[model samples]
Target: MMEERKIGRKTDLRVLKTQKAIKDAFKEMVMEMDASQITVKELSERAQIHRKTFYLHYTTIEALFEDIMKDLFQEYCRLIEQTAPDAPFDEVNRVFFTFMSRQEPYMERMVCAPSYRDFSDKLFMTMMIHNRSRYNPYANYSKEEQNVINTFLCLTSVNIYRQWVKDGKVLSLEDLIELTNRLFLHGISDVRHDL
Candidate 1:
């Protein structure tokens, strides 16, 4: 029994390492080429793993992409939770952008990727479901209204990030955050008020 347990633990560790290597290779490939262009054979070679091992973990490249997106979303959620425990939505947004700015290279690639729209939509939904109490700005609204507001917020924020990345991030992180906050919180009224 003791020997079996030891062997099982060893197998688990090996599996984890294999998966990490595969993921790392995938990330590197994605940074260089479009995700749709990456093949399982190339991925396996890059990871230094057998093709059968790749099949053991993921059935398709799309599945692997989804898994990676899921992992990234989970990490984003963890950053939010860690940075501002029980904080309000605005504060959570601040913490989120701060965390994302630190992950600029990864974020830029992911946001600009061809699969980004679907990935972002799914990630937004996951975050909404996972942190309903913390991130729901439409808690008092009806279900339909909540959906509309949530969609608007997600699209707006994502577009802003995409533009920032496309512009080569000319603005500092602080400036970017302030711009986001101004647009989301005060809207055009702040600039109009000055006029």
Candidate 2:
């Protein structure tokens, strides 16, 4: 069983607003410089909040980065859940690509920035943790094997997405989704598994 922490509605609203401001500031700052270059002082100044208030919400910039990743992962899970259980690969891919397309600029900056490579790696690991069950069909394999497979798949997907963003998304959303699905499902194997 899990314990729930309760807070007054007013306090909850204030916390949410402050967190959003901090995130917005971070995003804006990332566009200008690397995450490593973003100091708490600068972030607080950009967010128009005191440095102590930032500390109250997050212990460090890395914590804030993790929180942002958590938000994205949750949003992705929500979108995936909304998809029908029997949804075809194309449908699921459409949903995912649509979400990614909307967040393209921010994602591109985050992934391409050298200083944030560690953060990107951590984000991928976090996503893999959240998605492990979805990839666990080969029950005969050991946990380590399953983890290796999952990590490979996740890294491949991330690289493809990074490439798409780097290319300025020349392909239409639907086309990109189809391309990604086809590549992942078939992988030049010539075997046509109806994904």
Candidate 3:
């Protein structure tokens, strides 16, 4: 809107506004359809920014998606870190679920939208990479054991959370977290009777 001035290390306000517009438009598209289907032409139109302007901020739609994912992953790691350093794995995941439960609609869609599997998968893998350093549940077990256990723990929990969201959260968030912890600790056979 204003003349572009040399802002040095700081981002131009116009640039920030344009980026936010692009991001907001992309988010709307994600909510409306699968993320993979979004195109720059539609996003630029929706953002009311020129495609050239969009390029000034992000090289590709995938880049924008990764930018958003990085912000999300950072926030997730921060929340997970806030829990006690040596917290039990279940408790650590409780922190994750709690953070997830509090997401805004756009972010919730990123995690729970059936068409956004790539988005969700990216989020899941990012969480796992960080968790390896933060909390290793199977500490006493071999690396392979830890790998499988952590994958199972992370994957099942996120999917359970995803299913819960898709089902319109039939169980309260607290109940879902409790049930997830049960599944992690007791396994399916043990929880089958309760289900």
Candidate 4:
């Protein structure tokens, strides 16, 4: 869905403030609990907006989360396009990890914290969906096949990214990206004869 369609106006200060407040409230609640556990009633109260206002802005918690993620995803994708136009799928992880590492402090808590693994997964899944046209060569594959491939790549990458964050990023971003690339390409059965 278009962000513009969901948000009726961008130029109005009241609209911008309401959006920010809603996002800020979502972030705070997300840090405290899983995304699934949050409710519009609680979120609206926290944002100091009525539930109707929240509904006017977001139909569901997931929509709100996706909206927030799309903004970040677009920012990083722009940077990646500039720096690595037509970069291979493996290299895409580098930009993603770097982008995650550079997120604002409030986002760090929401994106990096262990309790928010779902958020991290959602973010990576969003990237995979958005990244398909630009990076996927398997577009010729059947729809089911594409889903399987996308699911494996997204979940595997998100888990690795999560572990890296939980372990305090012992591996440098480049190293971590390289690790994921190897796993994605080789898929553990490095010995082709065994497969």
Query: Per-model C-alpha lDDT, please?
Result: 0.77, 0.76, 0.81, 0.77
- TM-score of candidate 2 against the unseen true structure: 0.80
Candidate 1 wrongly placed segments (more than 4 Å)? 83-86, 133-135, 192-195
User: What TM-score do all the candidates reach, one by one?
Assistant: 0.88, 0.80, 0.87, 0.73
Q: After superposition, how far is residue 133 of candidate 4 from its true place, in Å?
A: 0.7
- lDDT, candidate 1, 72-174, per-residue tens: 7878778777744456657766776775666646556876666556765677677666666555556799998887877777777767777877788899888
Better of 2 and 4 by TM-score: 2
Ranking by TM-score: 1, 3, 2, 4
Q: Write the per-residue lDDT of candidate 3 for residues 38-151, one digit (tens) a residue.
A: 999999999998889889889998899889988889898878777776788678767888888888788788777776767678778778878777655568999888778777
Best by lDDT, which number? 3
Query: Who is ahead in lDDT, 1 or 3?
Result: 3
Q: CA RMSD for every model?
A: 2.3, 5.6, 3.5, 6.1
Instruction: In angstroms, give how far residue 188 of model 3 lies from its true place.
Output: 2.2
Which whole-number lDDT from 0 to 100 does residue 147 have in model 3? 75
lDDT score, candidate 2, position 135: 40
Report the error of model 2 at residue 5, Å: 16
Worst 10 residues of 3 by lDDT: 1-10
Give the per-residue lDDT of model 2 (tens digit) for 86-190: 566566557766876777466667865677778777776676565554543545889889778777767776777778877877878777777778876777563
TM-score of model 3 relative to the true fold?
0.87
Which candidate number maximizes TM-score?
1
